[model samples]
Target: MSGAPERRTRGRTSPSRLRALDAYLLHCERPLLERQDGPWGEAAFLDVGFGEHPWTTLESARRFRALNPSLRVIGVEADPGRASAAASHEEERTHFRQGGFGWAREAGQPVRLIRAMNILRQYRAEEAGAAHEELGQALLPGGLLVEGSTDGPGGITVAYLLRRGAEGLAREALLFHTDFHQGFAPRLFRDWLPVDWRRRMVPGSALHAFFAAWTAAWAEARAQGADSPADSFHEGARRLSQAWPGVSAEPWLWENGYLRWQPPTEVPRPQGL
Candidate 1:
């Protein structure tokens, strides 16, 4: 239960960020929509650490509601002032609450999805696993947990999709979003790796080698006069799949600006820390 206290910051929200996540959001929503007749008749989305603006939560609620009117979108904040400020922006099916990841249990109903962006950054790396376990307990069966952070004008972001499994929650995929023009490099994603894995980016590590290959491919594509970032990313993914055939089974499309791969069965822990 111990974690960083909520440190309030400027509320900068963009429609583009929400738009970029549209595809993944839809993918996460499908299952809940299909199971509408279950115990929790209506689907709920909890946007944890939603700042004062809560624009992302508001827009997300509006978009998802368009598909299923019964869906409820709640913006959650740990800072009381920000939560109160967000109240003014609430609409009919969308509301704001004052709490953190712990709010999940208090909901008294199953939650289908929870988005915790930039929330874990404040906590030490050792605290991430505990926070993840806590969040998993708040989900309905087969619920999805999307958590990550972004930087650089909002174009570069990395997110991990953790799906609720029979045992607990397991990381389903690792996603990356980057400005193709800037080219994909290992360093660009270093800051966004989950707290636990951030320090494990070294030789012999799956992620370190993965990014190395991506960077090499990007360089080769650019040298051959690839016109856009998408072109470079496609070439990079192709090279990556060629080197690691397992990648072929996952969604590594260039258009999504994400290279999603199944998480390793056992995540390698950082050594010599």
Candidate 2:
């Protein structure tokens, strides 16, 4: 494990806890998932901290393989016992391993994607930068690293989509999604944001400004007769996109409870990061 500091986290996870995230990726990252040239031809999708069971990992494998049947999937758990127990679910195209942030680099695996959901919640906010760098070290150029948190039933999720490029891992965008299970409100995602962004949503911060704009848009939409949760969300997102520089205006995203905010510049990093 490279003597890296170990992570001690709860192994509480349920089946399909990350299905929304998988679907988002399948829709937006189709090219990355389906490409089979050069390094991508042998790259693997690494699911880190897949918890007590490999259900989410297995679920993603099925969804992603629909695009590329030859894809390889590996589930990584920090707990040795949990890792061993998950081995029973392995197949010719899937595997389980005991490791942490640096696993892919140490194992000499080329990676096309890395999903580290709900893994860094227990870590101090200041530690996220190093963790991100470590996790992206093995990604092939143009590959992606999705790290974030989702609500228990997977009704809400906020993730960082970092893409590896010639310059390194770029903080490409902040992806927000919700099923409106708790009704629609911009603040519903505050608690589910990635660890680095969770503490940065205070006054004078870019994230705070972003949320403020969203709140305003929501209120405006409500005033315009968008009454239901779904209606408010869809209309608010449409207004936010018009007011915001880089918010996506795609009808599919708004209608389906998703908002992808990719600023013209990279997602602003918290001071320490």
Candidate 3:
């Protein structure tokens, strides 16, 4: 089937950046995997928009397979050239296919997770929701859909975790990562918002207010001589959580430079509306 246009970029990803994601998957699947009867039957992970050099795909597959030996990893690329290149690196349990989000349904099995890192950047902002809906339909019940991008040598990343709910697919959390020493910049977070939300990063929007608040807290912490970027980040998260009860400070924020928050459901109205 025809697919979206490819917008490839070169980057490096270290396995350490995925530690928080790994813990989350294990937590979500613990019930089934730890059941007395036995682990769930075979499960699959789809790495969408895996570019020509798919080291991230291979690394993710290896790490996830280590977590659950029964899992299969499939790299899906829209560019035929990239897909062919990815296939050259296939292992016993990992495979590659030339397709896009649409291929999620034709995988011949229910997908437990789909990672679409940096995929949405290739499409216009208006196309994000439709793309998400299409991919959502390809998930197994309770499957996860992680969509986002990384920046600054993969030390800073942002991802939105969505899960198939009874009503439909709902965003579960916003995941953030940064370098422990450098912390994160509010503007950098702005760069990571999903296509649809990127334009809403204006003065009155909640997302805008969120980063503004974070930036203020970060500045305050730095002025107070916080030991490191990690320390400043923790303080910023603390400030945000205190100001908005919806935010939470997670323990993983220290070591992994990760923080998660369940965003408010209401879409922020434009200022002066």
On lDDT, the leading prediction is 2
Write down the worst ten-residue block by lDDT for model 2.
Answer: 1-10
**How would the candidate models be sorted by TM-score, starting from the highest?**
2, 1, 3
- TM for every model, in the order presented, reads 0.86, 0.97, 0.83
Q: Global lDDT of each model?
A: 0.70, 0.91, 0.68
Candidate 3 is scored at a TM of 0.83
Give lDDT tens digits, candidate 1, residues 186-256. 46778778776777787887777767776786777778876566776776666666665345434434656
lDDT of 1 at 268: 38
> lDDT per residue, candidate 2, 72-140, as tens digits?
999999999999999999999999999989999999999999999998887878888788889999999
Off by over 4 Å in 2: 1-4
lDDT of 2: 0.91
Least lDDT summed over 10 consecutive residues: which range in candidate 3?
31-40
The residue-by-residue lDDT of candidate 3 on 1-273, one tens digit each, is: 323344555523444545545555565455433322222355568888766578777777666666566567888887787788767788787889887787868766567788887778657666676677777777766777888877635666777788887878887777776664444555666677776676666766777777777788778877887657667777767776777645756554534566677767623323432
